[model samples]
Target: MSTAAEVSQNNNVGPVMRQGELAQAVVEAAEIDNPDKIIKVEDKVAYLRIQTSDEMILKRQTIEEMLGRPFSMSEIEIELASFAGRIDTQVEYIRFYHAKHL
Candidate 1:
């Protein structure tokens, strides 16, 4: 059994990414969300852990806008090492959040 505080503490969500250009783009895109969020990026030699509290969203459009080129959301998978929480992927955006919160 878990208390509210436990749930809150475990609510952090994001992706562990393979290091390189793709991971860099994803991390940059995460920082550019409209409502904005505090994102934490940890370098782990071969990979990077990118996380935010409660929820985080990355838009294909935003990624493209940042890169100044055509970008496919699926391309992210190439760099994704792992992810926390449930993922809702759309043509326009990808979201990570706890199912219980939804």
Candidate 2:
């Protein structure tokens, strides 16, 4: 079995959000903001699992554009059911990635 550290080293990361409009907007935003990476979404009835290789970033601007209104990064916590890898959040963007060993 792979340990957490071993798994994290693979660099797969993303957000698992509750099934709703907010989750939908996140999916669209992730796709737009990370065009260089292949984004994958899995539906689990209750939530949506959105993932990407190496790293994934969701910009507030892109989400706001998808939502057609103002958005706050703090609001994402309400819909975030879980996540993979480490997360770095800012007022303008949220990033999911594995911390590289130096």
Candidate 3:
């Protein structure tokens, strides 16, 4: 076994964070929604990645159709802007994750 300094002395220095957990979270969420796309979350952040395997883009496009009327571009912008402002005003909780090497 070698210390991080010793490892870094010879090879690339930093530890790599694994994406399995994030991918699993996204897959789980997609399965629950029965989405046609393969969805994935990025780590613990409020981020998502969706791969359009099937005609999954249609599912997203249908949201407006289901609502009967389409919202104007300005209306959508205003709603999203308000949501962002509300999120910015809220308190955020953080937790530390410790990784154990074997």
Candidate 4:
């Protein structure tokens, strides 16, 4: 088991989203949008924790593509239960990141 201190030592950042289609789409989007980063997803039954080291980005376009429908960036709030690190949201993309490396 990992301790909180051990977990916090890494620069992991992303969202904890309600487990459903939207969360699945976001995970797929994060993977596609951040090809350089290793996206991680933790299945918590009730919610899904999607994250990456340092930074994780999800593009609206990628989500739309994953969902096979139009998606609004603001719509993410409906499924966002919590998040790690600082978040930067825009019309085109949402970024979860640490301000600096430890």
What stretches of model 4 exceed 4 Å from their correct place? 1-4
Tell me the lDDT of model 4 at 67: 90
Please give the TM-score that candidate 3 achieves against the real structure: 0.21
lDDT of 1 by residue, 1-102 (tens): 888866656667888999888788888889987356789999998999989877899999888887778998988888887998879888888998886652
Each prediction's TM-score versus the true structure: 0.82, 0.87, 0.21, 0.93
Question: Model 1 — which ten-residue stretch has the worst lDDT?
Answer: 4-13
**TM-score of candidate 2 to 2 decimals:** 0.87
For model 3, how does the per-residue alpha-carbon lDDT over 1-102 read when each residue is reduced to its tens digit? 988867533211111123344233323433444444343333333323332222211122232343345522222222221110011111121111223221
Error of 1 at 48 (Å): 0.7
lDDT of prediction 3? 0.28
The segments of candidate 1 whose C-alpha lies over 4 angstroms from its true place after superposition are 1-9
**CA lDDT, every prediction?**
0.84, 0.90, 0.28, 0.91
Clash count, predicted structure 3: 0
| Candidate order, lDDT descending | 4, 2, 1, 3
Q: Which sequence of candidate numbers ranks them by TM-score, best first?
A: 4, 2, 1, 3
**Model 1 error, position 46 (Å):** 0.8
Q: Is candidate 2 or candidate 4 better by TM-score?
A: 4
